[model samples]
Target: MTKKVAILGAGSWGTALAMVLEENGHDVRIWSHKAKQADEINFKHTNKFYLPAVVLADSIKATHHIEEAIKDVDVIVFVVPTKAIREVAKKVVPFLTKPMVIVHASKGLEQESHKRISEILEEEIPESKRQAVVALSGPSHAEEVALKDLTTITAASTNEDASKVVQELFMNDYFRIYTNDDIIGVELGAALKNIIAVGAGALQGLGYGDNAKAALMTRGLAEISRLGVAFGADSITFLGLSGVGDLIVTCTSTHSRNWRAGHMLGKGNSLKEVLESMGMVVEGIATTKAAYELAQEKGIEMPITAAIYEVLYNGAKVEDIIVSLMQREGKSEA
Candidate 1:
């Protein structure tokens, strides 16, 4: 069945998803914020900004106009960066109709509002015009996904049918999709793991070995689970694909943008310098603020997140941050 799929954002993840949908025998329309990017995908079949080497599928089309992309589309996949999601949602809201399943692929909560991507979507889009809201997340990296490598991810929604539909839409020989009902846990796992991946990258940059990375990842999962539990997510969900699975991959993989950014920061580069050099959005930076704020508001203990926040925002030296984390009183793992 060829369904019309509209993807908002033509970044690496967005483009990779569009390719997946196209390969799944669906017609995909992608909207890029930049006209040149849209033209590159639509005409040249190449998105130089994100997936430089991979050629996009012919079934995928691109446009700068939101309405053009969403009009008559069966499913709308929101793939814009977290900071830009609200603005894009507002732009698309006026054109939306009923029975449109919204699947958000972006990770990270809103900084000040502390809203998840689905929450923002609910607020921006009218209830009468919305259908099922779904989130797809896992350890899958956009770069590898674009190359058609094997990747596994979970599609979560309150609506079981919608989750299955999404799973069918994107699942392929190289891509495996699982379904989950715990939307909160899925989103939290996706967002929180990036923070830990940054910490893992910092360890690597500081010339630390696998022992340090493993310790960071393990303790990082604990902090993530604590925050998720505080937010009403199931504790077991943290052990699933969206949780520990994503964390392990992002923390250990060199392809993670958040990890790479942290590596530069650990090498004594300024935040501004690192971000400017990276060019792409490293979601963990903004997510760290949002996660930290949520932890404080909910009275949850997230020492790893707190340390990253201090290092990124308070100009704390990497070595000092490490010392502070190490000196914290240790407790038995429950």
Candidate 2:
């Protein structure tokens, strides 16, 4: 069954998802905050700034108006940055006149509350304005997804029906969807992996070999799983697509904004300079702060996260942080 979908972001990830829904024969409308980007997507059938090489389907409509985008839509996908999730959700609330499945594709927690994207949506969009909240995430990269690469992701929700609805909405020959009930694990894995990805990039920038990268990734998963289990997520969920899968891709690939930002930082650029050069949100920068504080608050030992946090926030040299991490008191690997 075809549905009207409103995606409230026009960046590369949002536009790439629009392509997936369009191919599935759904009526897709993308909302962009910038009028010029909206015009580019609509009139030119391309979003040069985000997806430079991919030509968006002419059937996919683009608009700068929020109300027009969500008007009578069956599904509302929030594809904005984590920092912008609350603001955008507030903007859409006044227009959510009917029950629609709320799905968010953005990854990362709210810096202040450390709440997942679905939590922010649930708080901002009242139960009357939506049916259920779902998080769609995994190792899939926007650039590769736009190229029609074989990709698989998870649609996680406390509501099984809503997850299945999203699963059916986006699944295609090249793009596959799996339903998971572990919303907490799925969301946390999706968000926390960015922190490790930054570390992986820093390793690359600092001239570290594959052995170092491998150790970082393995130990990083241990930290993520420890913190995740403490926060009520299923420990086994860390083994799934949203966990190990996401960590591998985001940490190893240049496609990750967090990894790219970390690379620049490891290469001796200031955080300010890295952010200015990326022209993108680079979620791990903010996520590192939130995760570090959360770990400390909960008494979870996340050495990798602490190292990256110190490098990004406290002006600690990466080399010194690495040495400090390596020289920590030895303990048995669980």
Candidate 3:
């Protein structure tokens, strides 16, 4: 059974997902902000800006016009970055019809509002127009996914039926999809782990080895779990793929944009310099601010995230931050 799926965004993740859906025999129409990108996808069968080497399926089409992308689509997958979700949602709203299931593949909270991506979607899309909202997340990276390598991810929503539908739409032999009802936990796990990945990358860039990286990943989960629990997420969610699994992969993998950006920062490049050079959303930088703000508001202790905040915003040297974290008062691990 083929379904019409509108994918909002054409970045690496979006293009990878579009490929996955197209492989699953769905009609995937991708909406790119840049007309040139849409043209490349439609005419050249490649998204040169993101997944350069991979050729997109001919079944997957691209359009710069939001109206064309969403027209008659059964499902809408929002793959834009966290900061751009609201703005893009607004632009797509006029084309939205009633009873359409919306799936957000983005991972992060709004910077100042601290709202999850689902919440942002709900706020941007009217209630009458929304049928179901789902969040897809896990340790999967776009580069690996684009190559059709084995990958697994979770699809979560308050609506079980919608999650099942999404699971069916994306699940395949090479790409596995699990359905979960804990939308908040799933979304938080997806968002918070990036912050930890940044810390891990920083450690690696500072000449640390596996032992140090392992410790950082372990303790990073603790910080992420604390914040998630404070915000009413299930503790066990952090132990799953979206949490610990994602934390490990992003921190260690060379393909992680966030980790690479942090690595450059740890090697003594300024944030502006690194971001300008990379020319893509690092995510963890904005997520650091949101996590720090959430911790302050909820009165939760997240030493690792706090330290990252200091390094990123307060001009604390990465070396000094690492030393201070190591020298902090020790406590029994629960």
Best by lDDT: 2
- Candidate 3 residues lying further than 4 Å off, grouped into runs, are none
lDDT tens string, model 1, 39-92? Answer: 887788898878778987766889999989999999999999999989998999
lDDT per residue (tens digit) for residues 1-334 in model 2: 9999999999999999999999999999999999999999889999988889999889999999999999989999999999999999999999878878999999998987989898899999989988999999999999999999999999999999999999999999999999999999999999999999999999899999899999999999999999999999999999999999999999999999988988888899999999999998998999999999999999999999999999999999988999998999999999
Lowest lDDT sum, 10 consecutive residues, model 1, at 50-59
Q: lDDT per model, in order?
A: 0.91, 0.94, 0.90
Q: Distance (Å) between predicted and true CA of 101, model 3?
A: 0.8
Model 1 TM-score, all chains together:
0.98
Candidates, ranked, lDDT: 2, 1, 3
Q: Which candidate leads the pack in TM-score?
A: 2
> Candidate 1: lDDT of 297?
88
Weakest 10 consecutive residues, lDDT, candidate 2?
Answer: 91-100
The residue pairs in collision within model 3 are none
